[model samples]
Target: MSSILYEQSLSFKRPLDFVFTYLADHSHMSDWAPSVTSASKTTPGPVRVGTHFDIQMRFGLSDLSLDYHVTALEHPQYIELKGKGETFSIVERLRLEGEGDHCHLLYQIEVYYQEPVSKLVRFFSPIVKSSIKKDLVYLQKALDQQPSSWKPTLWSKMGDRLLLPGMLHFSKKGFASAKDRWIGVTEDLTGRNIVITGPTSGIGAAVARQLAKLNANLIFVCRNEKKALIFADALEVEGYPRPRIEIADISSVLEVEALAARLLEKGEPIHALINNAGALFNQRGVSAEGLELSFATLLLGPFILTERLYPLLKKAGEARVINVSSGGMYMQAIALDDMEFEKEDYNGDKAYARAKRGLVDMTELWAERWKEDGIVVHAMHPGWADTAGVSAAMPKFYDWTKTWLRSPEQGADTVTWLAASKEARETSGLFWLDRTPHTTSMIPGTRSAPRHQSLLRERLEEYSQKLSAVASQSFR
Candidate 1:
């Protein structure tokens, strides 16, 4: 089989020099290229012809590790790199041409697949070309940002580890403060209809207050009406608008469906939906739908609610969905077989972690699918927070890690940022923490394969539709 060649070109709304400068800095490759999971300069000193770097990219179910060496450099006009790997060799060329203020980028990719793989490459050429053009859009957007934003500081590289010890289980409120984490944040969601679950306490309560300050019309969904009403009263006393309240046990799919129905009936466009209601139960329990409690609350309920509310979200033109997941999800794999914990002995922590994992996974799929509809879905973990839920659920660990735990306000910072920030709207389907996007999986075995991830999304949609039909029939 002959070598496969895939090429694409794009015109960026930036100067030729500016585009060249940004693209020359290979460190920013991961930010723009979705397939490039990670990259690093293996060779030291400034980048020039013959300088070497390594990149780990996604190739279907596996990673394609490649070493790239700069072969040619023609200053602001042209540059080329040659990559060698186990299964393939690649030659990438970028030729920049200036046209007034903008630059036309002629990018070409030549792949020499080793033997048996060339046939497969030929078959997927169309999809490959499409993905290349899609990645170019991300590249264009990233280049539009200030060059300074592309560089990471020394402290950011540590990511809160120095300020807090590894023994700490949660994120600290004051930790990211030194960086002025929320500086330049001025999102006024005034008059926007924002729905938030579990607004009675902890992160949810914190987010509600923040959004209220922004004059958003908040609609609180919670199992406890009294707590929600009390919170609303406090808001009202503080001169904030009285927020609309809806009572429902979020752990129950039927209740979530009914709640969605009421919201739909109102016909108001929902600007954003934040799925912040979650719990780590010490004992195993099933929801009204026979789903495990943690699975029901953390994953299933939010999934169904988001699925049902699609019409309202679309109606908002550019609405966002934020799923409040937990950093604890890093510890576990997506237990597809034991999603409900039916087969194995139920461990509440594992169940909670698995459910959060499922939620994050679904967020990725939803973001990809809903982008065309102008809807963005994102999942973020609150890190470690000093919340009543934590105190009650895991007391001993809480007692030890309490000193390092984030205040509810600290925990809600990223959630509020995601809900309100314009910069965040640029990217979707990413797992976020501390206002920065992080990889969904750190440990090798924990990451869900692409095929399995797709399967899970399908299964979730099927279940949501099935339950929705049942709920509709019962309502009749």
Candidate 2:
């Protein structure tokens, strides 16, 4: 037999005591591991040295049922486990050290295979090492966040490792080159009521086509009734089922309210809501309500619609809400004080970028608050897509960036994946691309903790409450 050993180290802002307590509990492994589906103790008391457990794992379509015996345990310091299988033997160890307010964790894994398979496994060592390293990074991120009060499980840890990379890579590459591979395999919107804004053109139009093929009952929202009808007619001509059309200028709060009321009156739950409608004005502009155009159309409109339709979303049970964000959000910090840019110099690109960032932030907040209700909210960047909007709004920018841009269909793949895939059911409030969840680059001088997400959530909730009050007063 031949053996392979791997080691990795990660640091977290949490205290060493917290890390030790968390690691000492074997059941917490399931919370961060993507491979281990379920973990349960065979010996009924608190986990300690010599405790034994059975772990269930499913990779792709293969089932791995294994028994693990705890070998060593040193409180606030180290743990070791050994697993024996028909084909292989595995040993795992973890060590923790305290450094002020931070904790450093070290992990080591050793694997041995039977003689006949040893050589083959050695040849695949590079791949395995790479996979394990990536998994560790995800595990670190999940542990750092300390998800809302829930018993830590191995499945959660495994999910972080399995889903983060593809999402990160896709965020960088967009969907053009990877769409066909991820489309049907990752997402299926069949038999769902899918509400989409801006369904007549560009990315919106492409998404409608894909959903039609998936047999989704489509609800198309657009400002121009004639344009919406035309798009609906085209879908029918293309052998798609007739979609319901709702004509309302999303930038107008009154119109948005009426639209929500009409949908609620219909008494049918919306299985998914895609907040895809938005415009980029090269010059400063204001909506009919006297709000900044980008703010009203991109952030406020979607926020209002989502709030009004919360009941329907809850009724859908395991429903999704996808916010189409942008890569540009990374370029600038949000100006919360001047969100409307009324007092400062307002560049369209800056305004658009901030709006997208707000959307991403809100998605995370909503997911954290609503997970128990069975609702999943996700934010995603479509990469650079070659669309009419791009060409019309910034022809020069499009021309400069066209070489890397994807088709509209390509841009929509991740959005569809997050909305319809079973793999995505447990994952929410994260950014995705190419069917994988991704981590955004950290802002300079910022701690790795989810501090930005927390701040955004606070600000958004405050603003939303104000908007809700305004809405109530208007109705009266």
Q: lDDT scores for all predictions?
A: 0.78, 0.72
Model 2 poorest ten-residue lDDT run: 179-188
Q: Estimate each model's TM-score.
A: 0.66, 0.61
lDDT of predicted model 1: 0.78
RMSD of each: 18.3, 17.2
Tens digit of per-residue lDDT, candidate 2, span 1-476: 88889998889887787677556655444434555544555664456777787776544456577778888988778988887766778898999988777989899999888878797886878866775675576567555653222222343234334544333333314232232122132123557899999889888887786677556899999998898898788767645678999998888877788799899999798899999999788799988768898888988889888877888999998789999887667656666677788987879998998788778777877888889988899988787788899889889988887776666766776676666566667678887655555554334422123676667556656755666567668878
Supply candidate 2's per-residue lDDT for 147.
27
Q: Give the TM-score of candidate 1.
A: 0.66
Model 2 segments beyond 4 Å from truth?
1-183, 186-190, 442-476
Q: Candidate 1, clashing residue pairs?
A: 170-384, 171-384
Which runs of model 1 end up more than 4 angstroms from their true locations?
Answer: 1-170
